[model samples]
Target: MMKAADLAAIRAIITRAKRWDLFFSLLGILSLMVGVLTFTVLFVDMAIQGVPRLSVDFFTSFPSRRAEHAGILSAWVGTVLVMLLTALAAVPLGVAAGVYLEEYAPKNWITDIIEINISNLAGIPSIVYGLLALGLFVYYFGFGQSILSAGLTLALLILPVIIVATRESIRAIPQSIHEGSYACGATTWQTVSDHILPYSSAGILTGVIIGMARAIGETAPIITIGALTFIAFLPTAPFAGDPPAGLFDWIFAPFTVMPIQMFNWTSRPEAAFTVNAAAAGFVLVFMTLAMNGLAIYVRYRLRKNIKW
Candidate 1:
């Protein structure tokens, strides 16, 4: 029933819209390729400059003033221990706070303010956390420049991220799931434990991985709290000390992480130290990738078991 002129106008509009769509589509592809290509080039350059320096001894030997002989033994070990402690300190608190906020806390202006503050915290610069940790963990609490202090600092840094991730993940569960659990005469805690927690665990782990990846690479906070740049020794091994050191004694040991080691090497005058820095950077990236890969695999497995 349309007039020929009206039909022609409609066709013209469709053509114009399609042209704009094509333009945006091409723009998006260009942006994605730019990022991918940039990363590929940088990674390849690092490998070309660093791969030859990697060897079995490079992993085993302690750092030395002689750059060619230096290794990351202490750096990597401290990174792992600090990360382990970070996880221990952050996970439970983040998860519990998230659950309380989402599942139990009353909806009110007070809760809104708290939620807004938490979200804002996620965007606060990492250096501010470092300053706070320096004062509270190092000077105030007398934790000193130790593994425990570093661990707790990084834990604080990532807590907001974990809490937000947890809330979002729990929010994603179907409303029907909660209603069904309630219909079965389940209590709030029971419903949450058996239904909510299991379903959202993958998402929670994803956040944890992201937070940890950020924590592992952070140098500002660690350095602010007096992490040594030239740690040639490892934390004292428990039960191996002359008097058999207490299990928690290592928590108070001085520490260093990979980024700090790389920073130290890169700042040196020698070319060999530059190569060492590149190699350490390569290994740090690999470790981060491996951690993410493992987390992705675990998330996939978790999702596979999910009924919906």
Candidate 2:
């Protein structure tokens, strides 16, 4: 029923659109490569500068006045302990808050206010969180300048991220899944436990890992809360103190993390310390990459297991 002229005009329009699409496709690839190549080049440069410094002695020794003798044992141990405490505090609370808001909280003005505040909080600068922690955790609660304070500060910093990720992940599941579960006479808790949580685990885990990656690299808040820049001794191992350490004793111990250690080295006047900084930076980047890789692996395994 179409005239030849009309067919030709329609074909021309599609051809023009296809050309534009191809242009954009190439543009997108170029943009992505620019970022990837930039990061790869920098990472390679850092490795070149730092790889030689990675040795058994570097990992085993503690900080020293001599740059050549300096190591990151104390720093890495503190980072791990702080991160463990942060995860322990943040995961359950963030997940619970997200689950409640998305599944159970009534849609009211108060809920809207809370949601808005949480979103705003996520965008606030890290330094603001540091100030808040200094006041609330350090002064009010008397947590003091210790691992407990740093862990709590970073936990608060990442809580909103996890909560947002959780809600979004839960929202993504098909409505029919919920309906089907209820149709089977499952209780609310049963449906959520048996279906919702399992289905969204990949997304939740991804968010958690991302939050932790950010937390691990945080320096401003830790410094603001009085983390020592040159701590040499490790926190007391659980149950290994002179008086037989209490279970939570280390939480109250002073600590230093990788970022602070790197900062300390980079600030030194000596060239040798600069090499140490580069090495520490390399290790930190590798840790971040490892966490991201774990996230990808988890997401893959979880999605592969999912029937839908």
* lDDT tens readout by residue for model 2, 162-255: 9998998899889899999999999888888898888888899999998999999999988998789988888887889688988888899888
The 10-residue segment of model 2 with minimum total lDDT is: 299-308
The per-model lDDT (C-alpha) reads 0.92, 0.92
Task: Please list the residue runs of candidate 2 whose C-alpha ends up more than 4 Å from where it truly belongs after superposition.
Answer: 1-30
Please list the residue runs of candidate 1 whose C-alpha ends up more than 4 Å from where it truly belongs after superposition: 1-24, 296-307
Candidate 2 residue 80 Cα shift, in angstroms, is 0.5
TM-score per candidate:
0.90, 0.89
C-alpha positional error of residue 43 in candidate 1 after TM-score superposition, expressed in Å: 0.9
Q: Candidate 1 on 1-308: residue-level lDDT in tens?
A: 99999999999999999999999999999999999999999889889888999998888889999988999999999999999999999999999989989899998998999899998988898888889999999999999999999999999999998999899889989999999999999999999999999989888998899889889999898999888999889998889879999888999999888999999999998999999999999999888887778778877886787666
The 10-residue segment with the lowest total lDDT in model 1: 299-308
In terms of TM-score, how similar is model 1 to the real structure? Answer: 0.90
Clashes of 1: 0
